[model samples]
Target: MNMSDILANKVVVVTGASSGIGRAIAIRAAEHGARAVIVSDVTEAPREGGEPTAAVIEALGVTARFVKADVSKRTDNDALVAAAEDLGGVDVFVANAGITLRTDGADVPEEDYRRLMSVNLDGPLFGAQAAARSMKAKGKAGSIVLMASMGGLVGAGITVAYSTSKGGVVLMAKSLADALGPDGIRVNAVAPGTIDTELLRTAAGIAEASEGFRKRTPLRRLGQPSEIGDAVAYLGSDLSSYVTGHALTVDGGLLAVI
Candidate 1:
């Protein structure tokens, strides 16, 4: 039950970790005694406008490295994992980088759709592939967690591309789990709903949607970034040894009702 027991000595790599849910995940993993936490993102600055994630983690006296990576590219993802391997083999990889645009199915532009697929879908796919390869090469057992969304589970009127990409991520996790199980590599996805983060605040019509999300949720409030971080930590730890190919929903009971 101690924080150190959860991820003690583990090497964790998290993409899109400069802010929001990803930043929280990196911080929590370090707090749980991860030996090395590699933060891979396009920038070091926090999107919500505060201290950089690496600085905060270093301030905690944890070994943290910030590697600039654009998750949309497979080469970038590969390099990101390589950076983590330099410290130690990656014991846990969280494919958390993603982007969302507010547009209906009919109004979605070709360029926008491609960008969504590249970042939201292909990012996890390539990241998992690279991480799995590294773990297998090192003859190590590892865990891979993909960031999914409630939109992937249900149809949302305004997020056509985003929903589709996330839906792909959900199933991709399952497929990867099946493929990597033989290598003792576990794969899973976390579907978060309405977490109060910079990403959600900047989403189109979030103000209007926030009230609806609160009213529909049994918890009557938005989930916090750290809540999602806790879920990732659990999935990455031995506590979830028997769990894989599953989409853990942390939605404040919103999905339970629907």
Candidate 2:
């Protein structure tokens, strides 16, 4: 099979598919000839502005569906998985929905922290559970890709809650891989560093810190969302069949110096 067809005929479900990294992943799956690509998110509109992810996929002559879902809720996650199973069994699940707060650790508000954890941490936990259950019931080995962040491995002075939540996701992937391995399900995470997403551009102090961020990285640049998508596609495909519990970093070499 061709490299682009790594996920041919597979059913893929992506959370936060409305935009940014999630949108890129869903589109890439369709490019890989996925039988059905389910785009799950709180909204159908793209955050950075453009056609909805499902529309983009369909325009590519691939099967795609949009399922409105709030990943923090278990019911929503389960329903999203069911929707994917309806199209075809889910062969790959990308838990890419996440949020962040830009407050200093000492001044972080309770509500902000809770909200961040709910989406960033709880989202992946529920998504992984639902996808694993479906794969197990169908008697198929599958892949689950959780979205972690470079913040999780390192530290960000003002992003206490966001960093903590991503850290939980990294470990969650590891623990799930251990528990699900016996059942033939693989779990992993992609940690992106300073991706050029709208969210990052609008992040507090990011504009002022951009130069410093670039200078510290060996690549001397920010990563693109599509770059992270490519990493996720690899983890979710047979190319990395023997890989599990690994956190693939898609950073532009930022972590190397840090």
Candidate 3:
């Protein structure tokens, strides 16, 4: 199949797509020929400043619909799926909405922790629930991609809450894959390392990763949002039909040494 036809005729729903990694995933999926791209997020504005995700995807000659959704809310997630059904039953759902704190593990506040978990942990859970139900109802074999982080695999003292939430996501993929496998719904995750997004820049207290931090990776550089987008595209496409319950790490080999 041609590269662009990998997801031809598919309808993809991506949360947190107003900016950062989620935006890239939506755009990449459209570039790969998704029939419709459901761009869902809490708001329509991009945090990094650019055209809305739906507009960008539409410019690529793909159908795009903007759905304002908070993945942490079950109703919102269900509504997102409903919007996808208007085009066609969801073929892939990318639960990429998440957040992190700038504090180290020990000093996180209670309110901060709760808010973080709601967005990071509960968001994907609700998204998976809504997407799975839609896919099963439509009798379509669909893919679910959760966003995980490098800290999920290894203990990161700096971002403990974020890591803890993503660890749950990693296991969530495995558990969901087992439960949904018989129904032909595949579940997977993509764990990224220090991608150069506005979120990372704000969290790291800089415009980009420190040169010392960059050198620590085997690739000797930070990852890009588009690189994570590519990995997610693989999981959402027929290229990874047999792949499920797997966490594809796209950290520029940062996990190799650490």
* Ten-residue stretch with the least lDDT total in model 3: 204-213
- Name the better of 1 and 3 by TM-score: 1
Each model's lDDT: 0.90, 0.89, 0.89
**Backbone clashes (count) for model 3:** 0
Per-residue lDDT over 26-136 for candidate 1, one digit per residue giving the tens place of the 0 to 100 score: 999988878889998999999899888888888888889999998888899889889987777899999999988776475899988998899999899999999999999
Model 3: how far residue 120 lies from native, Å: 0.5
Model 3, position 78: C-alpha lDDT score = 91
Candidate 2 — worst ten consecutive residues by lDDT sum? 1-10
Model 1 segments more than 4 A misplaced:
1-4
- Candidate 2 TM-score to native: 0.96
Better-scoring candidate (TM-score), 2 or 3: 2
lDDT of 3: 0.89
Ranking by lDDT: 1, 2, 3
Residue 131 Cα positional deviation in candidate 2, in Å, after optimal superposition: 0.3
TM-score of each: 0.97, 0.96, 0.95
Write model 3 residue lDDT over 43-82, tens digit each, in one string: 9999999899999888888899999998888899999999
* lDDT of candidate model 1 versus the reference: 0.90
**Best lDDT among the predictions, by candidate number:** 1
